[model samples]
Target: MKRTLTILSLTTSFALALGACNQESPKQQQEVSAPAQTVEKPESAEVVQDTIKKSIPSEATGRIGDASIKITYHSPGVRERVVWGGLVPYDQVWVTGAHKATTVEFDRDLIIAGKSVGPGKYALFTIPGRDEWTVILNKNWDQHLADEYDQKEDILRTKVKPYSLEHPQERLKYRVEDGGEAEAGIRISWEKIGIRLPVAGK
Candidate 1:
């Protein structure tokens, strides 16, 4: 009877030890699983956001003389509120386009309606007006700034009369048109504003 009791006691001790080991394995699994949950959530959100910005295609083109001027305006619509709402704000220099400074080139120095312009690329900028507008020619052709534009680099500043468009423009556009007798009009228009700069050959 003692021998049988001893065997029963040994079996009971082994079963208790097995039960304790099974309980500890689940506790170890919970500790390992908790750390994995913390790391994955924010990383997944960032990847989704970056995908959205890449989907927008922002580019446009036009010509400004014998010279072909490529214009890349803002992809998003240019509104008076966005352009005037302290972003492009009023009575200040605007680069006139989105990416690089808006570029205008002349094939050679020609008397643009008696005004002399040398052959080269110039940065085109503008100052909006309620009654009239100003088209500016600046020597510096690269770099972008809302506040960093220097008027000293400006080669010329000319007044233009802004006209109301019959139809709303979806994107800003520039083109050179035959102005008769070796002259052309460098027309810039968008939204409600349409202005032309007349250029003539020397």
Candidate 2:
């Protein structure tokens, strides 16, 4: 009777140990199958262009007697490109700048190329030619390029002769020079040519 009881106890313990191992086997398999989550990294941004546009802002200011005169424009570089008949076409209205219309302001009434102009701001435009260029002053000072330019809005139109520059100018430039008393000269230079327009108080 004692030997049989010991055998029964040993059999029960072995069965319980086997059952515990079987129950733990599934949890171990689940831990091994599922890996830890990881975060994904984003890609680096790229640069689109290597260089910026060439057009830049320019301003010229001077006094004609007691009247203040100012000109604001965009200066474009020659960059080995033909400017006269190629980039800036002839016989057409040009903005005289790159993105916006060129502006001319006067503190008092002034005479430009024999035409009377405003005491306020005005848009400056030009029609370029090989020998002579026509300069126009419009009442509409705020505009984009020459696309919105209208001939009916012109307040003053005058013709000026273009001269060849012995030294080449790489960029477009506008200058107002004080010529003695009430007289002032507006000079526009670009590429290999230049033009001068006389201005005086009316």
Candidate closest to the true structure, highest TM-score = 2
Q: Supply candidate 1's per-residue lDDT for 170.
A: 48
Please, what is the TM-score per model? 0.60, 0.72
Q: Candidate 2's residue-wise lDDT over 113-132, tens digit each? A: 88766699999999999889
- Candidate 1 ranges with C-alpha deviation above 4 Å: 1-76, 79-88
- Write candidate 1's Cα lDDT for 82-152 as tens digits: 44335445677777766567777666565553578888877888887777777888888776734557889
lDDT of 1: 0.67
RMSD of 1: 10.6
Which candidate wins on lDDT? Answer: 2
Model 1: residue 186 alpha-carbon error in angstroms: 0.8
Model 2 TM = 0.72
TM-score of 1: 0.60
